[model samples]
Target: MILLVVQTLNGFQLGMLLFLVAAGLTLVFGVMNFVNLAHGVQYMLGAYLGVTFAQMAGGFWAGLVLASLSAGLFGLALEWLIFRHLYGRSDLDQVLATFGVILTLNEGVRLIWGSAPLELAMPRLLSGSFALMEGLRYPVYRVAIAGLGLAVALLLAAGVHRTRAGMLIRAGASNRDMVSALGVDINRLFRLVFGIGAMLAGFAGVLAAPLISVEPGMGENVLILAFVVIVIGGIGSIRGAFAAAIIVGLVDTVGRGAITGLAHLMLTGPAAAKVGPALASMLIYLVMAAVLALRPAGLFPARA
Candidate 1:
């Protein structure tokens, strides 16, 4: 029971980070009808900027603010310079171009930060642990991360469902041409969505910096998981992304532990060790496949 609780909490933490990244990616994909293979770059930028700014400012809070703003601005610049030009191109062109951006930026990051992994010091306020039960003491920082993510998710949900900007975003997602005909500056909306998406991804990166190593290419794996999230949740659906992220996170984390324990019961020790991890790694993909097989359009498709 204690182990289950701990693993579940860990899953939630991972899910929260995934949600932050996937939320933005889904918004951009839905609103712009564009595939951005380079979305991970913004995440990498966030972590790097968060660490640099924090070190320079000598304060974690200040660094987070500065890094988020910088990330948003950089995203805007990318949209204006590269993404805007590709809006009308084929998905193949968009994918190829953005993939180039990924390669360029990855190399740029290597040149700037070198190949060494960097670490962000945890905030002083959250650098301890608290007892969650008689036998379990959980890290305060992890709880804070989960709390922060939940807060952000709530705000995002409200913004999408209640605000006029959100309504415009929704309308644009449903039919960009129609929204444009109705006098909406679809291009401006695209920029706004893209910028917001980038900022959210950056925010995730900042939050994750302390927990994981900040290094070049760190965002690639997260990006793949985020893609799985958006796909499983239904492309362009924020709610779907949230649910899917949590599902993926839990399956990936808890499944590893659970599957391994079960494997030990059924197989030799060495075989179980090898097979357990391999099966656990495939859990999320299998879930995605199941969801797609049933829903085809995803659980919460934007149109639905």
Candidate 2:
């Protein structure tokens, strides 16, 4: 039972991280109609930069701030140089250009950081564990991650609902031509959105750095999951992202942990071992397939 609880928390922490990455990807797709495969590279950049900054600044917070700022600035520059040219192009063009960016960034990181994985030390304040129940102690850092995810969700909701820029963003998502017709600077808006999206991805990377090894291609696997989150949540809907992230997180985590246990009861140990991870990995996609078959649009699509 305690093991179940710990796994549940771990799943939620992972989901929150996915939400951060998906939020940016969905937003960029929702508003700009651009398919950016390179967004994952921003996450890789964040993890890399965070480790470097932490080593230089000798603190977690300072490293996080620097990492996020650097990633955002990089996004802005990319937007100005590459994304700007592709905005008016077709989806295929956007995909190709972004793919190029990914190759360039991945190689750049390899050249600068080498092929070795970088390690990040968790902050001293969050390095300990707290008693959750009898004989159960959970890492404080996981709890901190969950808290940060919730905070980000609230801020995103408020931004979209109450803030002027969010209003513009929503409007743009629905009808870019109409929004542009209203004399809004769509280019500038895209730049801001891209920058924010990059920062969010970077923040997720930084948070995950200490938990996971920072290495080249670290973002690729997560990026695939983030896309699943976006698809389940609905491409343009923040609320949908939040709900889907939690659901996917719980399902994936719980399924991975429990499948083998359940399989062992029915099958032999070797069989269970072989089948468990495979089945667990497919669970979320199965959920996605079901959702697609039923709704087609998504669970919570942005208001039209």
Candidate 3:
């Protein structure tokens, strides 16, 4: 029971980070109709920046601010230099161009950071575990991370549903042509949307830096996972993203542990050990496949 509780909490933590990253992805895709394979690079940039700034500032707090700012600026610059130009192009063009950006950025990072994994130490204030129940103790940092994610979700929900900019964003998503015909400065909206997406991805990267190895290609796998999240949640639906992220997180974390144990029981130890983890890894993808098979439009596709 204690083990289950702990794994559940860990899954939520991972899901929260996924939400942070997927929120941007879904929004960008829903509104712009553009596919950005380079979105993962923002996460990478954030982690790298966090490492660099942390070393300079001697702490995580200041480093977070500096890294987030840098990532946002970089995102905006990329928008100006490349993404904006590709908006009217085919999805294939966007994909290829963004893939190029990914290659350039990855190589650039390797050159700058020397292809070595970097890590940030958790802040002193968040570096321990707390009693969750009579027999369970949970890591303080993980809970804090979960709290931060919930706070961001609330803020994002409020921004999307209650603000004027959000209304414009929704309008753009529902019908870009109609919004543009209404004389909305759709270009400005696109830039803001893209910048926000980049910032969120960067923020997620920085948050994750203390928890995982910061290295080249770290974001690539995560990027694929985030796409799975958005797809399952319903592309362009923040609510869907939140719900699906939690689901994916739990299924992924728990499936790995529980499925392996079950396999060990049902098969020879050696075979189980080899195949169990492999199944666990595929578990989420299987879920994604099931979700798509059932609902091609996703669970909460942009309210349309």
Candidate 4:
């Protein structure tokens, strides 16, 4: 029971991280109509920069802040130099261009940091666990992450629903030409949106850095999962991304943990061990497939 509770929290943490990544991806996709495969590289950049900054600044918080800023700035530059050109191109062009960016960034990381994985030490304040119940304990850092994610979500919701810029973003999502006709500087708006998106992805990487190895191409797998979240939740909707991220996170976490246990009960230990990880990995994809089949438009499409 304690194990289950711990796993549940881990799942939630994972979901929160996914939300950060997917939210940005969905925003770029929904508003700009561009498919960016290189967004994941932003995440990789964050992790790398966080580590580098932390080493330079001599503190985790300073490193984190620096990493996020650097990532956002890099994103802005990419938007100006690369993504801006691909905006009006076909999906194939977008894919090809972004894929090249990914290749370039991945190689760049290797050149700067080498191929070795860098580790970010957790802040001292977040290094311990707290009792959640009489018997169950949870990591304080994971709880902090969940709280932070919730706060970010609320802020994002407010930004989207209350701000004039957000209003334009939504309008652009539905009809870019119409928004442009209103005399809005669509190019500038695109730059802001892309920067924000990049920052969010970077933030996710920073949050995840302590838990995972910061290495070249670390963002690739998570990027795939983020795409799946966007597809399941709906392409243009922040609300959809949030919902889908949590669902995928929980399903992936719990499914892997529980399936192995269940398999052990029904089959030999070796067989259970082999099957558990495989099945757990597939669970989220299975859910995605089912959702796609049922609601081709997605769970909560942006209000079109």
The per-model lDDT (C-alpha) reads 0.92, 0.90, 0.91, 0.89
- Name the candidate, 1 or 4, with the larger TM-score value: 1
lDDT by residue (tens digit), candidate 4, 183-269: 999999888888988998898898889989999999898999999999999997989999999898888887788888887888896
Q: What is the lDDT of residue 138 in candidate 4?
A: 70
Candidate 3 local lDDT, 168-216, one digit each (tens): 9988988999999999999999889889889888988999999899998
Measured against the true structure, the TM-scores of the candidates, in listed sequence, are 0.97, 0.95, 0.95, 0.94
Judging by lDDT against the true structure, name the best candidate. Answer: 1
For residues 24-119, write the lDDT of model 1, one tens digit per residue.
899999889899988889999999999999999998888888898899999999999999999999999999999999999989999998989999
TM-score of 1: 0.97
Over 4 Å off, model 2: 132-136
Worst 10 residues of 4 by lDDT: 132-141
Off by over 4 Å in 3: 131-137
Task: Provide the global lDDT of candidate 2 against the true structure.
Answer: 0.90
Count of steric clashes across candidates, in order: 0, 0, 0, 0
Q: Candidate 2: how large is its RMSD?
A: 1.6
Which candidate ranks first by TM-score, i.e. highest? Answer: 1
Residue 51 error for model 1, in Å?
Answer: 0.7
